[model samples]
Target chain A: MTSMDFLLLTKGPLFQIAIAIFALGMLVRLVEIFALGRPHNYAAARGGQLIPGLKTVYKRFNPDPGTFKRAPFDVIVGIIWHIGFVVALLLFIPHIELIKSMFGVTWPGLPNPVVDAVTAITLFALLATLIHRLTHPVKKFLSTPEDYLIWTVTFLPVLTGYLAYHRLINPYPLALGLHILAAEIFLIVLPFTKLTHIFTAFVARWYNGAIFGRKGVQS
Target chain B: MTEFSLERGLNALREEMDAPVASFFSSCVHCGLCATACPFYVETGDPKYTPIHKLEPMRLLWEQEYTLWGKLKSKLGLGKQVTDEMLEEWEPLLYDSCSMCGRCSMVCPVGNDIHYMIRKAREGMVASGHAPEGLIAASVRAVNTGSPMGLQWKTLDVQIKHVETATDLEVPIDKQGADYLVLLSSMEIINFPEYLEAITKIFDHAGVSWTLSQQCFEATNAGIQIGSKDIAATLVQRVVDAAESLGVKNVISPECGHAYTAIRWEGPNAIKRAYPFKVFHIIEVLDQLRAAGRIKTEGKEMDRLSMHDPCNLARKSGVIQQQRSLMDLVADNFVDLEEHGKFQWCCGAGGGVSSNERAEELKMAAFKRKKAQIEQVEPERMVTMCATCRTQLEEGLEEFNMDIPVVGLTEMIADHLVERDKPDDAAAKAGG
Candidate 1:
């Protein structure tokens, strides 16, 4: 296929299909969870639930001291990567234009240099995570093949996006096409893999806090 | 009798896949933070005891039953099947090593309640007949004799006579329309009769009207420890029936952590109704009494003292501050363990681990965490509320050859009540 045709394919039908699957899969999974429906807690609340529930969603951004002390490397890298990924992916000028065309949403993009710095730092964080997983016995023990696969998918979109932005791999269209394809794959697998934690983490934290909060214990 | 089979275990697990369970399984990021949070993993450095890994069988069952891709993978024979052998292998991981302390739950970055999942996984273990024999026997005895230790009210009656003789106080029994219905665990009845005397003196001094039911006095729920709701409900029903019959306004759970949890938190849910009377852990009630100027103490415990917070009471039920409040009342030199209160480490004998003889070594190993925390404080005495925790603390300290005396907080408070001319006058003064 010509470079133009390959670029068109990655940017056209593949992108649409990936977004469709991502949206549909997330909706169905969330619906399935809600459909199961938690039983109403019959006990009287010792402390109001709503405030603590909200607090937990906010509080987990800064972990408790004990947890931080135990898993400093993981916690630090995890927070950095999450912030970097969001800033790099959503605030880059090209990605904003893509979102504007698809969803009719508009937002100012970060400057190109700022985006480049975040993208580089986030890639390093991803590599550090992979190294930690391989070398840390507990991480290695808990990881399944699916864990590594999800990591690879999540890592590639940023790596290839950065490559395409710089045009470091010869033939700019081919490099850009590879970036789009990697992103499409990442989106397609998001709901099915542990990447779903990106969405479920808030709800899980809220529930954990609510349960403990009702007992008058802060999470 | 139905035979234990893989199908039965799988069905039990599938039935437990509620909203929280589904979200928890989906949201776990495999960060291994839970391992660091777990005393078993942290103490032993064994990856197998990682809190999430202990629930692998349940996770497999969730995958097979709930997920579309999991179904496809199973169809293609790429998925792991939860076999009977797997359940057998995981029994020790689920019951023996785990104390259900919930430190892992608190530390989970994605907010998965690993402790709750472990509780759910126990249902399958029990259904599959892979539960420890000690737990099964305890459950059976709890149902048959109304106490897991198989002690009848007759045993408590004998202890009551001793308490009466020692305190020169009447231990009220089955008194209708009393303000509170007090329950005792078998551990208290056998091992610590001073708890009965302590309450009698304190309640008399406080002018509190309380009664012990001849019909239902045991507070400990073996069914909970064994992870059987039906059996737990049956045990809980006895207390509900006694409380409703007595028309008490409250039920005071004794100084046992799981007993407090079973009655105050899990009991109403198990029976599917809000209780007619509220429940309070002994420490909570004591704190309330102290807040209201009901309890008056005359002396302080003259030593450098620290506390051991039971997991179920402090972490699970929010009884952390209440105990500390009461501690502040009677102890002049009160210092806390570095990790006391809601963040306190488990005594390593909760959630039926103490009952399972096979878990003794692991339980002691887990105690090293608490031991180290205590050593950091280096207190002359250690005070705690839960009887199970007290027993574990005593045994653990004895094992380590530590001379620190572990005293029940209730008994400690009782030891310092202001003297009065008569019990009647004391009651009248408290009432006035």
Candidate 2:
């Protein structure tokens, strides 16, 4: 067949395989969540009361209520790190482009300069996190091959997408194809590995906060 | 209930489960930061005994099973070695050794609860008949009879009567429809009646519609400490049912740390259902009265009061901050001990070790740790939120032989009972 038809065949098979793998990963995660249920025996956490006074958590967590104020750095970093990661995962231009191509829907795009700046921040965070995993003894000890695999998978898509944008690799289609493959692989792995932490962590934090919150305590 | 030759059986269980727990164990990176948070580690200066170190065998297993290189190393028997002897040695090193304070989790960068891991290990060992004779017996007594002391019904009757006589306040026996049902740890009634006296005075001073049921009164649930979840559930259910029968709006837990945690945190699981009534630690109730103007303080004198954090309450149950804040409300001398809140040091008496045969040695080491903490601030009294801590601290303090009082929040509240100084002669004569 012609070069265009060859490219067309490649896209169809890759997309099909990616979707199948993503579905399998999601199925495995469901088994783990329900089958390996933890002991959620927190009673005070389950009820809500119209408490008139200060909450129990503030009394227990900080003791001194005045010490509860957040530092500006905490507010800024906590917001920036959480929001930036979420948006990058959902709205990163190239990833969004892949979504549009797969589903035949599209959205407005970011300016090129803004895209460049955000991609840099994502890469910077990836590198810093990798360094922490390697250097911090606790993280290093607790981490496994799956952990490193998740990290490697994250870096690949961003690196390839950035190269594809600048045409740094000369051939645009080859680079773009590999970038899509990387994104697909990352998605399949996301729900299976410690990458699933994104869901479990909020569950843990909110549960902890809610328990103390019901008692009129800061969680 | 499960019995075995303490030393040998412990080894065998540790042997059969060596690969699993030891392999799962490599998750901790001992930075010695956990030491500052653990009373035993801080007092003994022993790295091997820190809460994280208790997971060393499990870490050995984690290395063998989960990691790429560690699995490769295990092929040649090169990963952290696990043996029956190693498991045998870890009995004291893991169970009798650590208090399961949960403070280590607060300082852990990952919030890894090494103490929970230790307790889980002990449970596996206990299932295989590895638990100490003393602990096993107590667990047996609790499951069979309702108290750790194995107090007979007749004996509890005498104790209840004495409590009523001493405090001149009615300590209800199996009463129904009380506004509050006060649950006491067997430890308080059997070992320290002075605590009962204090609790009675608070009930009387506040004029709260409350009662104490002789049945279902043992607040100490050894099931929790021994990791026997079913037994803990059974023990907690009795009290839950009693409170429901009393129809109280709240069930006030005495100054026992694990008791508060068991009833408040594990109550739902224990009963397999929820009770509508609230469960409050005695400190929580006292704090409420002080805030509501039910009980007024005269001097606010204890403002410089330095408090010791009981492990089960502070870290596991998450009441240390509330206990401290309530103390701040009552005293002007509320000097916060440095390691306060989730970051505070353990009382070193929890995890069923309070009644252990080795309790004296463990209590001594734990006291040394707490004494140094107390000396830093040197407050007038070391206030506590748990009855077990009060007992252990009092037990530990005899070594120092200092005159500093060890008072529970309830006892402190009893001291501040401000009932509008009645015109002495007139009030005495009226007797209204």
Candidate 3:
């Protein structure tokens, strides 16, 4: 297919299919987790759980002092990439416009230059994490094939989008088509891989908080 | 009894597959931050000691049985099964290296309770006949002889008599309607008879009615360390039965971390019923007495003192402030380790590691983390509330040739207690 035809295919039916699989897959995974159903704590609680559970959902974004001191680079780069990725995905004008087209909703977007700088920084941070994962002994040992695979799928959308936006690739349609295809692939693979952490991290944090909170700890 | 096998182990893991475990495994991103939080990995620099990696067998079983992708893979013969051999290889990882300290759980960016998973994973290890022999023997002794160390009530009775003679105070036994029913660990009975004396003096001074039961004086639960709920429940039921029969208002867990965790937190859940009375760690009780203006003290210890927070007590049970409050009551120069309270490094002897003879070298290796923390502070003496932590601290410091002595917070508090007047002096002074 020509570049224009390829762009049309990605933005039209392929995007819808990708979104469907992404949503349904994540739903099933969440159901599987929740259906397991934690047993009721028969022991008396020393503190309230609901507030602590909610607190931990937000608190875990920042690393504890010991953890940060132990692995400063990992914590700093992890925070930077996460914040940069979200900003680039949601605050860029074209992405917001795409979302508006898909869901009939729109929000004000950041200036193109600002979004561009964030995407570049995010790409660098992702690369740094990948290198760390490959070199850090514990991370290297813990990593599986899925870890590298997930990292690539996560990295490609940002890398290709930045390239397409700057028109670094030769043909505009070809670069744009590649970017959209990369994002669609990301969505399809996300719920199936460790990337499910995007949603389940909150659940995990809540459980951790509730368990410790019942014992009057702010974990 | 049926012999332990891989099938039983897999079944046990299946039983442990609850929502928290599922969420924790799903949320993990293999960042290996848990290793940084674990003392075993921090001290030995071994990637194999990573907290999440230690739960590999249980995690594999969870994936194969619970998830769609894992099920599909298993059906196609592409899934990894938890084999007996795999569990055998993992015994040290699960039992020797881990103290169930929960620091990893605290530092996991995604909030995976890695220590909780380790505790559950041990259930599988024991069922598969892969548990360390020391832990198995301890569990057996605890179940049969009522103490993991195989000490009898007569052993504790002798300590009680010694404490009564030393302090010249009554040592109440099976005193019905007492305010507190005290439990003791075998470590305290054998290694630190002074614990009984300190409590006796403090109780007498505070006018608190307390007694020790002849039936179930032992508080440490081997089942808890061995990761067997059935055994844990049986041990817990013994304490429950003893307390109920005595009709005490509360049960006091002695200066042992796992004992406090066992009876105070896990006891009710293990037996599937709420406790008729309450449970408190000795520090918590002392703190309460201090707060209520019941226990009066006259002096502060001048030594440069620091504390070792027990994992089960500080991190797991949230008894952090109680020990600190008790310390403040008697310690004038108390310095905290760089890492204390819920984030403190474990003494490396908890969760049955001290019981497992094979884990001796590993336990010392883990103690290096705590040793480093102590070296940073350079305290003259280290104080702690848990008996197991105290023992480990004493042994580890001696092993390293550190001059810092270890003391129990309770005993220290007892030493500083204001001496009360005799009945004759009180009456004569009132008349004058």
In DockQ, how does model 3 score against the reference complex? 0.86
Regions more than 4 Å wrong, model 1: B1-3, B423-432
* lDDT winner between candidates 2 and 3: 3
**What TM-score should be assigned to candidate 2?**
0.69
Tens digit per residue, CA lDDT, model 2, A67-86: 22312222233334445555
Which prediction has the highest DockQ against the true structure? 3
CA lDDT scores, all candidates in order: 0.88, 0.63, 0.90
Model 3 DockQ class:
high
Model 2 docking grade: incorrect
Which runs of model 3 end up more than 4 angstroms from their true locations?
B424-432
Query: For each of the candidates, what fraction of the native contacts does it recover?
Result: 0.69, 0.07, 0.81
Candidate achieving higher lDDT, 1 or 2: 1
| Weakest 10 consecutive residues of candidate 1 chain B by summed lDDT | B423-432
**In order, what DockQ does each candidate have?**
0.75, 0.08, 0.86
* Winner by lDDT between candidate 3 and candidate 1: 3
Alpha-carbon shift of residue A44 in model 1 (angstroms): 2.6
Candidate 1 residue-wise lDDT, B1-432, digit = tens: 257667776777777788878888889989999998888888899999999999999988887768776777888988778888999999999999998999888888888888988988987888888999888889999989999999998888888898776666789999999999999999888888889889998998899999999989989998788777778899999999999999999999999999988888888888999999999988888899999999999878889999999999988988888888898999999998887777889989999999999999999989999999999999999999899899999999999999999999999988888865673444433421
Using DockQ as the yardstick, the better of models 1 and 3 is 3
Per-residue C-alpha lDDT of model 3 across residues B1-432, encoded as one tens digit per residue: 258999998888888889999999999999999999888888899899999999998888888888898888899999677888899999999999999999999989898989889888988888878889999999999999999999998878877777766777779999999999999999888888878889988888799999999889989999889898899999999999999999999999999999999998888888999999999999999999999999999878998999999999999999998888888899999999998898999989999999999999989999999999999998999998888888898999999999888899889988888888877544322210
Candidate 1, residues A1-219, lDDT tens digits: the string is 977789999989998899999999998778767777787677777887888888887888888888898899988999999999999889999999988998899899999999999999999999999999998999899998889999999899999989988888668888999999999999999988888888888888887888789988888
